[model samples]
Every structure is written in C-alpha cells, then in structure tokens.
Target chain A: MLRVLIFSIFASSAAFAAESGGMPQLDPNSWVPQIFWLIITFGGLYIVISKIVFPRLSESIEQRNDYVSDLVDEAKTLAEQTEKLNNEYKELISNSKKEAQEIITNGRKKLNAEFDKKKNELDKNISELTEKAEKEIQSFKSNSIKDVQTIASQVSGELLKELSLNDEIDQNIIIKKIEDISKKKMGELN
Target chain B: MANPMNQFEVKTIGPKIEIGNFDISFSNASLFMVITVATISLLFIFATKKKSLVPSRLQLLAEMAYEFVAKMISETAGSKARPYFPFILTLFLFVLFCNMIGMIPYSFTVTSHIIVTFALAIFIFIGVTIIGFVKHGFGYLKLFVPSGVPVVLLPIIVVIEVISYLSRPVSLSVRLFANMMAGHTMMKVFGGFVISLGLVGGWLPLGFSVALTGLEILVAFLQAYVFAILTCIYLNDALNLHH
Candidate 1:
C-alpha cells in the first residue's frame, strides 16, 4: 500500500535525520526538491497572478473609481443646471413683480388725472348753471315788479274813472307818483 | 508521542522520481507549495470573476490584498517599482498563504523551511541586483560607497556597506524563516505539553497555546508584510540608488 510505503519512507528518513543529528532543513537530501518545487510553484503563481488575477482586480477597481467620478460629475452638472434654472426663475418672478407694480402705479396715476379733470369739469358746469339760474331769477323778479306796478297804476286809473276822480289827476302824475312810491317801497324792502 | 521536529520533517508523498543524480521526488513540502499556489490562484480568480462595480466579500479580500501590496510598493519603492508589482504581490501572497496554511493543524508550512525562504530571498536579491545593473549600469556599485564619507573613512565605510548589502538576502530570508519556524515550534511545544500534562494540568498549556496561536497568526501576517516591504526597500535602493 502507498500508506505503508509512505510510513516506511517517513521512518527511514526520520532515522536518517536522527543519525545525522541535525535539523531536516539542513539536510542536503531535501534541498533540491524543496528548491525545485519552490521555483515551480512560485513561478506558476507569479504568472497566474500577473496575467490573470492582478489585471482583473485592477480593472474592477478602476471601473468602480470611474463610475464614482462619473456620478459625481453628473451630479455636479445637474446641480449647476438646477441653480441656473433657479436663478432664471427668480429673475422672472422679480421682473413680473416689477412690471405688475409699474402697471398698478401707472393705472392709479391715469385714474387720478381723469378723476381730477372730470371733477373740474363738473364744478365748472355747476357754477355756470347756478349763475344762469341766478340771472334768470333776477330778470324774472325785475319784470314781475314792473308788471305789478303797471297793474296797480291801471287799477287805480280804473277806480278813479269809476269814482270820476281820475280826470282831476294827471295820468303823467299818477304814473310818476306810482313810480316814486314803488321805488321808495322797493328801497325799504331792500 | 511524536517528535515535534517530525512535523518539519520532509517526507515523500508519492513514488520517488529521479533525474540523473537528483532525487527531486514529490514531497509534502511540494504538495503544500502546490496547495498554496492553487489556493491563491483560485481565490483571486474567483474573487475577480465578476469584476462587478459593487464588490462581494471575496472580491473585497482580493482587492484589499492588491491594494496592500500596491501601496507597499508605491510607498517603499515609489513609481519606479511599478513594473515589479506582480512579483511583490505574488511573493507577499505566497508567504502569507503558506504561513496561514501552516497555522491549520496538520498542515505543512512551506515558509518554515529555510531552503524555501532562502530561495525566494536569493531570487529577489539576484533579480534586484540585475535590475540595478540593467538600470544604472556599473554606477549601481556606488551603492557601496557612501557619498558623505571622507576619503580616509571611505574604505571602511564602503566595506561595511558592501557587507550589509550582501547580508540583505540572508537577513531577509532568516527573519521570515525564524519567525515562522519559532512560532510554529513554540506552538507545537506547548501543544505537546497540553497533551502530556493530562486533563487537570493541561488547561494552562492549552491557554498558552491558544494565545500563542493568536500571536503566531499575527506574526505570520507581520512577517509576510516585513518580507514584502523589505523587498520593496531593496527594489528602491536598486532603482533610485539612494545612499
């Protein structure tokens, strides 16, 4: 069996080591195999790692780094765009507010001017109508006073005629006297 | 009871194979090396299979390892060491996996062996040296001659510098091998005590073994880190030729 052979080999080697009275590492018989295997295994490892493992790891790491930086760049650009939009929005709002305020002020100024003009026109019309009415009343009062004096003098003449006293008085005198009396009565009333 | 050294003993796993005078038969050490290599390769391959933007845990692990070694190279050796990233990553992962695998009960620790670590360190030393020559020509020899030393002290200083430079591989290899070997051996020794002390007295050694296992795991990671960083430092010296 391989086990027995392995055991025998171990036993023989152990005895040989004992006979040599030294460490097995110092044993010359084992050095060749150890070095040979070391060269083979280390060489193989170096090749596999350099050719395969290292490249893959570095590639993935590089990929992750690139992805992260790209994300950051995208986020930065997006943030910048958002800020630009925000500034535009703010400017638009302020412009509109200014325009609205200007419109309101202009409208108020126009309305105030129109109101002042209309009020002045109405005041002038009212004063002109009042003056016309006052003139008409004054004219009517003077004419009515004249008519009353004429009627009084005519009635007096008729009464005098009926009484046969009008022929004794002068028509001119009667008219003059009525005029004087009316003048005096009017002055007193005034 | 088994000898604690028996765990370190190199044993043939399959039928012996010979090429000329060399007995380069498959061994437990070899098996573990294959396992370490296989595990690392598979884990990474699987981890990066999706390569998704959002990483899974396995992918995160693979990336962390990549980043750790990448940072180590960039920091210690600078950008000039970029070409050597794979080598450093492989070295770090290999030693790390080997140490970690060894922590598992009954698993072989490839890095615990001196020949294995010495092989790696010597390879790095030779490779870095060759890189230095290739990059800087013979001017790389100026590494041994300090710039600030006076003419009289230059000889002594250069000698010291040369000796230190030569000892880089030895120190690098020995540091890792000794830390791993000592930690594993100590754990094994305590483990032996736990078994021999019986149920009533074994709790103490058991506790120590548990604590030691934790420390050994930390040492395993630290040793791997130290090994990789030192290699980076060496690479830096060779590339930059800094005093």
Candidate 2:
C-alpha cells in the first residue's frame, strides 16, 4: 500500500539521519544516567505529591465544601425563621382587627341603650309638665267663675236700690234670681 | 544547516559521578528531569501553602490537574483505581512539562528519547500486571481468554490477545516517544529550510515552522493526556478484566 511505502521512506530517512549522528537515545552509556536521574526525580516527585501536595489540596477543597454547606444550612434556617415571623405578624394583625371590631360593636350597643333611656326620660318629664299646667288652668277658671257670680249679686242689689223700686232687696234672693236668669239665658243660648 | 538531532544530545554538566560500572554523571537530561520534578513540586507546594477556602489562580491550576487525573482514572478505571491518583497525576504532569519545556527553542525534550518513555511504560505495565495478579490471583489469566469466541477460533484469539497484552508497554512508550521526536524533528527540519532559503524565500518554511510549533504544543498536551488515559485503561483492564 502507498501508506506502507510512505512510512518505510520516512523510517529510512529517520534511520539515515540516525546513522549520520548517532541517536543519543540509542547510546547505552547515556541510558544509565538518564534512567538513574529519572528514578530519583520521579520517585522524589511521587513522594512530594502523594505526601505533601495531595493532602494539602484535599484539605482545602474539603474545607471549602464544608464551609459552603454550612453557610447554606444557616441560610435555610434563617429563611424558615423569617417565614415563621411573617406568619406570626399576620396572625397578630388579624387578632387585633377582630378585637377592634368587637370593641366598636360593644360601644355602639352601649350608646344605643343610653340614647333610648334618655328619650324615655324626656317623654315622661314633658307629660308631667303638661298635666300640671292643665290642673292650674282648671282651678283658675273655677275661682274666676265664683268671683263673677258674687259680682253679679252685688250689682243687682245696687241697681235695685238706685232705681228706688224696692227698698228691701235680699242679697241672697237677688243673687239666686240672677243666677237663675243667667242659667236660663245661657241654656237658651246653648 | 545544523543537525536537528543535535538538540537531543546529552551533555554532561559539572563533575562526573560514577557508581559501580554505570556512568551516572549528571547531564542536561538529568538536569531537565530535576527541573521537571522541582517545577511540579514547588508549584503544587506553593499553590496549596495557603490552603485558602477560595483558591488563587495557582491553586486552581493545581486543583485542576488533580481533578483532571482523578476524573480520568475514575472514568476509565472506575473508583477502585482511586489509590493510583498520585501516580497518574505525577506521570501526566511529568510528561506534559517535559514536552512543553522542550517546545522552547534550544531546549532538550527528555521524553523524546525511547529509553525514558520505555522505562516509564514498562514500569506501569509491570505494576498493573502485579496489581491484576494480586487482586485476581491466577484468575487474571482470564484476560487473555475473552468471552463468546467459537471453540475452534479460541486458540488463535488467545494468542493474539496475549501478544497485544504483552505489547502494551512497547506501544505505549513508542506512541509518546515517536510523536514527540517526530514533531520536534519536523520543526527542526523546517527551521533548516528557513535558513538555507534565505530571507525572501524562507518565509514559507518559517510560517510552517510557526504553525508546526503550535501543533507541537497541542501534541505535547495531547500525548500527555493519551499517556495518562492509556495507563488508566490498562489499569482498568487489570482491575476489572474487561471483555
């Protein structure tokens, strides 16, 4: 195949170049030192990495992870506390609202009872005053009627004397006569 | 034109040291390896020094690398592979830094060499095998005998499976080494063209070199990812014995 040919050509050229200036890699003399140094260096590196480097890196990484997780846990607890406080605040607000509503209704009921009692008291006082005024007016009318009757009697007697018709005029007779006459007139008018 | 291969050459630095028969002298490769190790160690150490709840940029970088490998292992090999996080992270960071550092002009790529990658890969392969055996005992051999094959084809299938299993290290190491080496070599080759062609005519190769540099950077990250993921996959095979 063309691929094989190309590879052989490349290999031959590499060999020719190798033969021209001996490949240092093929020199057995150098291998000892290279291998020796390689063991020392590689072994030293392995120890350093395994013992020193790995533990340090792992510790730091583990520490970071632990710190981050602790922070997250604290944040979660804090969030829960906030939610609890918010719920408590809402409950307090609702409780105060309910108490305020009860207070307002109780105050209105007390005011209404006082208002009704005062209205009843005012109605009674007004009725008592009107009844007293009516009684006073009735007594004054009776007394005035008595005074008018007496005056009528006196007037009749005087008029009889002045007229010179009858010298013996009895006041009671005159008064009775006047009263009967007036009664008859008043009855007739009624 | 400068030999692009010279960039990979190992040069001794300071006094040479020998232990027994081996020439274990400190070289540029060794220096860079130390750099790679020290770079990761210091960066990570500094990043986590504060251990602040909120990570700084450097800390974020370190965490990202850690999480990246952790996620890769968990996804590929399951949570049972959690213990291997440090090893996989080290491997990934080491390879990634080597490739990235190599991207700088005139710097050496430690992983571009076969022996280095091979060593790492062979180590991983052996470690994974040991884990599989430890975890499953003799039952780990069931990995070579997949399920739902015809009895007649079982022999062929088992042989193929065994070969592929054994080739894991070679393939794993070569894939990273070849990619790094080829990309660097290609960039070097194009860079040579830029100089030989002179100012007016060299713009084309210069543009290609620039583009190839970007691709190589991507390849650098990608190869590291592949190397890590492949290790996770092999670990998965060992841990779970996937059909």
Question: Could you tell me the TM-score of candidate 2?
Answer: 0.81
Model 1 pairs in collision: none
Clash pairs, model 2 backbone: none
Off by over 4 Å in 1: A1-20, A147-190, B150-152
Give lDDT for model 2: 0.88
| Cα displacement (Å) at residue B209, model 2 | 1.8
Where model 2 places Cα greater than 4 Å from the true spot, the runs are A1-22, A126-190, B14-17, B145-157, B241-243
True contacts kept of each: 0.73, 0.72
- Candidate 1 matches the true fold with a TM-score of 0.85
Looking at model 2, give its docking quality level: acceptable
Model 2: per-residue Cα lDDT at residue A159: 58
CA-lDDT, candidates in order: 0.88, 0.88
By summed lDDT, the worst window of 10 consecutive residues in model 1 chain B runs over B181-190
Cα error, candidate 2, residue B39 (Å) = 1.7
Q: Write the per-residue lDDT of candidate 2 for residues B116-136, one digit (tens) a residue.
A: 999999999999999999999
